[model samples]
Target: MDCVKLPDVGSRSLTTALIQFGFVQSYPDYSLFTYCKHNVRLHMLIYVDDLIIGGNDTAAIVKFKSISIGASIYLGPLKYFLGIEVAHGPEGIFLSQRKYALDIISKCGFLGAKPTSVPIEQNHHLALAKGTLMENPNRYRRLVGRLIYLTITRPELCYCIHILAQFMQSPRQEHWDAALRVVRYMKGYPGQGLLFCSDSDLRLYAYCDSDWASFPLTRRSLIGYFVLLGQTPVSWKTKKQHTMSRSSTKAEYRSMVTTSCELKWMKKLLLSFGVAHDEPARLYCDNQVALHIVVNLVFHERTKHIEVNCHFVRDELQRGNIVTCHVRTTEQLADILTKALGKEKFAYFLGKLGIRNLHTPI
Candidate 1:
C-alpha cells in the first residue's frame, strides 16, 4: 500500500470556515461521518484531516465510537437554520421565523406602533403622487426588503410587498405608512406560518388570476398564481405583467399561460422523482373568456393584442398536459395577491390558502 499525506490542522479550520456552518463532531475510533441519501445508507470515515465516506450501513462507525470514545452520537433535531424556524408537531412540520420579523420591525422603529387590521386600505388607489416624499428612502427600502423575505412563509403579505417594492426607488411617507401597516399586521400574526404534512398528497394544482390595469402609473396588469400540493400551498407569485393588457380576458389568459408553463415544468420534475399524476394537472381561472381561448383553437380578432407566447396555454391543453377550469371569483386563490380586498374577503381567501392562526392550536 502507498502512504498518503494529510493536510495540517490550520488547513482543516480554513476549510470549515469557508463552508456553511454545521455541526462538527470528532471521535477517535469512529472512522467517518455518515448520512442518508435518497433513502439509502452511506458512511464516511475520517482520519485526522483525510476522510472516506460511503457504504450500505454505518453500524461499524457507531460501534467503534461507542468502544473507543465511550459516547453515543446522534445527528440532530435542528429546528432552525438561516432564519427559517422549524417546529415538528403531531399535525405536521410548521416553519417560520417570527424573531426575524420582530428584528425588522424594531430596526424600522415600528415596535410600539398600533396594529392594523388590513395591510392595504380597501378602495384606496395608491398613486405615484400620494403622500409626502420621505427624507430617508433607505429605511423604507430596508423595511420593504425584509418584508419581501417574510413572504416566503407569509403568502398573505405578497400583495403588500409587491406594492411597496415598486416604490423602493423613491419611497414616500405614504409608502412608509403602508409598510408599517404590514408590519403591524405581522405583529398580530407573529406565530402564523406555513405547515407541510407527511400525510399530504403530492398533487400539482394551480390557480391563476390577473387584475386588469391595476397599476395606475403603468397601466400594467398584475398576474398572480398559487400552486398547491393537495391542500397545502407550495409556490406562489405576484408580478406586474410586462405589457399592458387590452382587457381583463387577455390579462387572465396571460396569467393562465404562465401557470401552464409552471405546471409543465412541475410535471417533468415529478416524473424524475418517479411520481405520476393519474390525471392531467388542473389550472383554475376566474375568467371564462380565457378558459374558452385555451380550449378553442381558432384565434379571434379580439385576441390579436395577446402575444404569441401567451398562446402556449392552448398547446398545453391540446397535449392533455393541463386542464383549465373556471373557479368563482370568491374562490380564486390568486385574488388575494392580484388586488386589494376587504377584511372579510381577505380573511376568507386566507383560509382558502391553507393559512390558519397557529396561536390558537389548530
Candidate 2:
C-alpha cells in the first residue's frame, strides 16, 4: 500500500461507506461515526487504518465486525491500542502508557536515577535561564514530543510538559535537565494511569485555573483545565495564553472560556455516544473575580480589555450549557495543571483525578 495515497483513498472510501450505512459523522470529531436505531447505538472511532468499535448492543457489534470489508479484522477484546495499555476489571477501564513511559525513561538513561515526588520543582523558573543552546536540539525536541504523547494517559504531566515544550526551538542545558527531572519522576510510577470507575456517574464537570503572567519572558499567563465525566477525566490541557493578560481576573476568565468550549465539545461528543447531557456542566473556578465576570452582566467594563471571543463563556453560561461556580483554592483540582505543587498536595489531587496503578498489589 502506498503510504500517502492509501490513507486518503482508503479513509474516504470507508467514510463514504459508513455514512451510507446510516452512520452519522460526529460534528465535533469527524473521525467518529455513530449509529443510533431506537435504543441500540454504536460508535466507531477511526484512527488512520484502525477502527475502534464500541456499543452496548452485542448483536450490533457482531454485525459491524462482519461488514463486507474483508480486509478489516476483528481484534477481539482490546488489551493494547496505539501506545496505551487498556485493562478491564471490576473497578472499570484502566488506561496507561506503562511501556511507552518506560521506553522514554530508558531512552533518557534515567532508569537508575532517583525518582522525585513531584514532576517539577515548585516556583522553578525555567524560562529565565540563559545558557548555550544544545548542539543537537533534535534529541530534546523528540523527547519532549514523546512526553507530550505520554500525557494522553498521564494528565498530571501536562504543565511540566507544556513548560518543556516551549524550549523545543532552542533547547539549553537547563531545559534538558528539567526534562530529565520529569522523566525521573515518571520512573517512580511507571504504572500510574487514569481509571474509569465502574460506579462513576455520567455527570460532566470541569475545573479551570490560571497562573497570572506565569511566563516571565513573554508575560503570558498559563491556563490549565481538567474536565471530567463524573470522575473520569475526559479532556485536559495546559497552555500559555497567546496574548498577555493584564489582570488575574482576565487570565482566569480566559481560562474559563477555554474550558467552556471544551465542555460544549464534550457535550456534542457525548451525543454521538447516545448520552444525553441535558444538564449544565458544572464549571469550577477558584477566582472569585473571574466567576463574577462570568455570571454578572454588568461587568463588561472590567472585561472590555479581554479578547472578544473570550466572552464565549458568557454566551454558554446564558445558554444553559455550563454554570460557573466559585471553588475554594484548596479544592481546585486543576491547580496541578497550572503550576507545580508540594508532594502532599500533588498526591492529593492525583488521587482525585482517578490516577492509579492497576498493577499495584492491593
Candidate 3:
C-alpha cells in the first residue's frame, strides 16, 4: 500500500472501524495474536479528530496497533494528539495548549492589544440600549461563540462570558465593547488554564445565590451556582431566571431548588465512581429568608404562591439529603456569578472562588 498517497483525513473514523473489525474477526487462529494483560484499565478518549490512548497495557496496545494498521490508516507516534499539548516525563504528563491560545489571540487581533487586569470592569452594566447597535450581528455572534469555547478551560471568565452571550441575537455596540474587554482579559492570561491536579481531595461542595429582579428589561432575577471538587471549581453557571419572583426570598428559594437538583445528580455520579456520600451535602445560601422558608415546616400565607415543584428543596431538607445554611453576603463566593459588582468586590469574589491570575509567578 502507498501510505504516502492516503489523505490525512478521517483518522478517528478509521480507528473506530479498525477496532470494530478486530472484534468481528472469526478466525480460529486468533490465539496466535500477542496479548498482554495488566491490572490498570486503559482510557481512550476520542474528540473528533483527536485520539488519546493511554493505559498500562503496553503489549496489548502494540498488538492493537499492529491490527489497526492492516485495516485502516495509521497516524505516527502521538506527541500532541489534541488541542491539549502533552509533554511526557518521569514526573508525569504535563498538558497545556499554549500554541492554541496564541493562535486564538492572533486570529482575534488581540495579540498586540493592551491587556486588562479584569475580564469585566467593576460597576459594568451592559444594557443593550446604552450603545450603538452592531452593523453585523453575525460577526458579534461568531466572536462570542469562539470566546464561549475558550471558557472551557477558563472558568474565571465564565460569568463575563455568560453576560456577553445574552446579546448574541441582536448585539449592540456596547455588547461588542464588552466582548473586546473579555479578549483583552484573555490576552493578559493566555497561559491561565485549569490544572487537573493528579492528586487532590475530591469532596464535593456547592454554593447557590440569586439576585432578585436584576435585569432592567425582564425584571427577572439571576440565579448562579458554583460546584467545587475540593478547592477547585469543576462546574458553574450564571443565568437569568425563567419566571419573575415576587420577593427576594422567593427568588432565592427557587435558586435553592435548582441547586438541589444538581446536587442529587452529582451525588449519583459520585456513587458511580465508587465515592459514597453518607450524609447530605451542604448548600450555602446568603438569604436568611430563603433558609427560613426551606426549613420552616409550617405553611404560611406568604409562601402559598410558591409552586409545589419549588418546594423540592424543603423535601430534600426534610430527608436529610441537603442541608441549607445562611452564608454572609460578603463572603458568598456565588455572588459574582449572580450579578455585576464594583471592581474591588468583583476581584475579591473572583479570588474567593479559587480563580487566580495564572500569569502571576508562583
Best by TM-score: 2
Poorest 10 consecutive residues of model 3 by lDDT?
Answer: 25-34
Residue 243 of candidate 3: its Cα lDDT? 95
Model 2, 152-269: lDDT tens digits are 9999999999999999999999998899899899888888899988999999999999999989888899999999998889999999999998899899999999999999989988
State how far residue 224 of model 1 sits from its true place (Å): 0.5
Quote the positional error of residue 188 for candidate 1 in Å: 0.4
Decide which is better by TM-score, 1 or 2.
Answer: 2
Q: What is the lDDT of candidate 1?
A: 0.73
State the lDDT at 49 in candidate 1: 47
Q: What TM-score against the true fold does each predicted structure earn?
A: 0.78, 0.94, 0.77
The parts of candidate 3 lying over 4 Å away from their true place are 1-100, 128-130, 357-362
Tens digit per residue, CA lDDT, model 3, 189-219: 6766544445646777789999899888889
lDDT of 3 at 214: 82
Q: If candidate 1 were superposed on the true structure by all CA atoms, what would the RMSD be? A: 8.9
Better of 2 and 3 by TM-score: 2
lDDT of each: 0.73, 0.87, 0.69
Per-residue lDDT of model 1, residues 219-310, tens digit only:
99999998888887878889999999889899899999888887887676444344677688899999998898888778688777677888
